[model samples]
Target: MIIITAILQMLRNGFVLSKTVIFIWGLVLSHALVSNGVVDVFADFLGDEKYNLWKAIMVKSFLEGLSAVLKVAVIHVSEAYIGRFKAIIFCTGSFTMGLVLLWIRASHLDIVTLIFAIVLIALGTAGKEPTLRDFFDYQLREKVKKNCTEKNEGEDKEPSQEKERSGKNDSAATNLWWSTASIIGSVIASFFLSSDHWGENFEISSIVMGATCLLFIIGIFCYYPEEKPSESPLTIPYRVFKAAIKNRRLSYPSSKQDYNNEDSDDASSEDFFYRTENGEVHLLPRHPSFSLFLDRAAMMNNSDDEEKVRKEEVCTVVQVRDVKNFCLIIPLVVTLFSYNLVSTSGNTYFVLQASTLSSYNIGAFDVSIMALFAIKSLITFVVRTIQSRYKVVRPLWSIAVGMFFSVLCCIAAWQVERRRLYLKKPDDDIPMSIMILTPQYFLLGLMEGFAEGGLKNFLSDRLYSESMKNFVEPYIEMLLGIGKFSSILFALVFYKWIKDEINHSRLDNYFLVLASLSFVYLGIYIFYAKFKFQRRRVAVPAETIQETIERMDELLQVEVDINQ
Candidate 1:
């Protein structure tokens, strides 16, 4: 009830409840339905005698994560050209085809067929589910801008604060629904999945997916404006890098006036400062020591007086700032891999280990162990509740907190797995209580709430550009995909550690390795947060490189002192 109230309150504060948002929410339900329902049950359904963890679980997981990384290309390259609607349609087709392939696999029980199906579904969900939600936010903002402008024009009235769109609140509300649907999907899947009922699970997932797709189609036709291929934001980084390389020798002008004069067009050159979503203008640093090559692109004056550089070879001051920030963000994305890599690998292993335990019951019927995977979503829902109640918005620090917990979760898994293995020496089935896994799931839930929710807040709060914000979300998913891709590498690297039977496999060692690397990456995050990200970045007055560095250090010292 509190969650529902939060949703209504958020919508009341200038949310447009657009068709695109509904479509995205539906996509989330469809994906969640299959993931917790079908993926983990593969070995059991296909007969554990024939399939093992390597084939049934790890193989499917690998391709799914790999597909997520691959979706970056599909989203930017293909979606950039064919229009978002067509790209969405193509992804929807893949999702439907995957379910059809799953139905076929049920009969033949082919590994190749199952893998192909998993890839298709992963590509569809990864490419669309998150992407659509972001698009909804973008579209919502655009609509708000339009409506506000029209009202102002008509009445000569100033747009109120309530009329201004709040992306953070709106995004939180969207996440609330998405998380709830995910939990429900997991529970629904449990009822539909047993060894004999696995076929029914896929069949139901296909129907749900199809129904959602139909709804999205109807919504698009009813509400979508005519599609136009906008200039891809992906090209911004390329242009900045290209211009930086071409004009590396050139130095920036002494005055803001000269910078303004260097503008290729009045539109790009309009300001040295960029406006945030809340109407605060942050003036970018004029001459920062870091990435000085980027500063050169802002200088329009050629060293050779008679020589002329092409238009494509130069960008405005604001573009240079945007590009430099983009570069800084890419390295930090590696540290984010710490959590995703651990979760992607640990989740399937958790389910397999759960099956080995004596089944727990609720009254008459036994509960599906896979339903435990829903705990993360449940925690996320709790985070949403706290956020809605308190209006919390600590974006970057929340992410760090999430990463910290993720390392602990990996450690917890390692200890529990080691203990489980120790007790399994005499009997393959140790009759261990399922309660042993509860703490791991509990920690995972905290990680999900902070890490995932924090990422959402970070995007809505820190990022200044709408175009960049939209692209960054997909980029983050790609990072997660890379994390997923690395899981395959880990399994191969520790091949002997993973056996056909859970009892024989030394997975505790595997968890240990993941925890160690995640700990190292967590250290990187702390170092970067303290020294790099927290520092007074390239967003200040025109100053000499030395003065800029000193100022940044001084400001960083203040921040550190405050933290202490």
Candidate 2:
């Protein structure tokens, strides 16, 4: 309800509200549907076999990479569209294809069927999605601009003297109305999608979704004006509308009643900073937002000059030469130890150990331990909620805590492995009790909740610069994809090295590797603290070339201060 109200106010302020809402809705739905679909498909392919951790990880990574490729391809193709509605349709169709692939996998469909489906989906996505949307937006923007100018001219209003146009007008109340309707439609669609019954009703849900999509797209095309003024673009008004809707300029008391509800407060804030650009120095307000105005192409033109500075900095690499040299040695040891611990960790052996204890029949998704893993994910979700609600745990601190928990989880798994080893005294006898391994899997989920979650937040916060914050989510996801790729490569190498060894029950050896890696990482972190890391690097103005050179030289000469 609050989101709905806030969205309404945003639209009233004249912003392009539908696209943003759609993007968010699309991201959530796409992720959920794709995640479930892929998991279902992969479980079918793998069956209930007790493969090594490496093989499981490999299949997961490969599927993830394939998903990434599909996503990227869809995005590129969608960009060519002039009509946004056309693009949306294109994207929806493309992503649906990916979803279908998973469905086929889950159904244990033939390889030929899967191949044929993929080829068709790929072709549809690559050929159609991009161009339609690009064409739509281009035409829509051009028309809207012309209409706005004509409307102003009829009223004999003076043209805006502002040099820039920001896309805020698209967020105005009317625009919000469109978006609100879209959100409603999306929410409705989510309900049907979420339901378990698919007997004949599945087609109905698909029809509803298709109809809603068409309605929204057609509404945009028919409602928006056909021509725009060449003299006055829609940019400035859009910019103004954006600022007003975002509530970028105001501060309110934390008490709920301090302002007349969130919407009123937002409206008040919008009034304060509408159409304003540039921030005053040394005036940091409680809530602040900045817009990126500079063009990236302009920045790229200066990259040649940027490389020279990097080269000179490399020369000064010798200043801390002794320190970095010493630091480099630790990661190798840490890498080995961390790998060792993880190998024997509960997650690594959970599957093999769990199957023998009882007849844990596979779920509809074909997963052997659905109920257990789902509960773990739920616990992690609760932990995440608690962490978010209470600001007690800082991002980096959460990361540190997660790492601690991960180590503990690994150690606990080591204990289980040892117990299992002891119980199987010489005559191939395995422990039938699964309860022993339960805590290890539980801890793995907890560790994931803390460490991986924290790492994700930290990386996103640190690497997403002001200009590229919008792209940060995708970029980080791409990095995650890269990490998975690396993990796959690492597993392949490990398999090659150990495949020849006899009885190779090197499980203990693997556990040791991870534990040692963690310690090694800790040491390297200390070294980073002692030498390489810097807390606050305030840029000193260097107006002249000589001054700039000296400044660079000074930075090179000084050892990096770890503590800010």
Residue ranges of candidate 1 with Cα displaced over 4 Å: 1-8, 11-28, 39-49, 56-58, 77-79, 134-180, 194-196, 256-291, 303-312, 381-396, 425-427, 452-462, 536-564
lDDT of each: 0.65, 0.40
Strongest candidate by lDDT: 1
The digit string of per-residue lDDT tens for model 2 on 1-564 reads 543454455545544434534433333333233222223223223323334445555554554444445544444433222333444566556545544453535335454554454443433333221233333344435444665665566575545621112234432433333334434433333333322222222234333334444554555534443332221112222333343344333442222222212113244232221122243111111111222211111111123524633432111111112122222223322322342234223322454445434332234332233334444555565455455435346655564565566666666755766666566645455644655665766776676666545544543443212222222333333344444455555545556433321123544444445555665665554454334222311122225446757888878667455333
Clashes of each: 0, 58
- What TM-score should be assigned to candidate 1? 0.77
Error of 1 at 359 (Å): 3.2
Please report, as a residue range, the 10-residue window in candidate 1 with the lowest summed lDDT.
Answer: 274-283
Candidate 2 versus the native: TM-score? Answer: 0.46
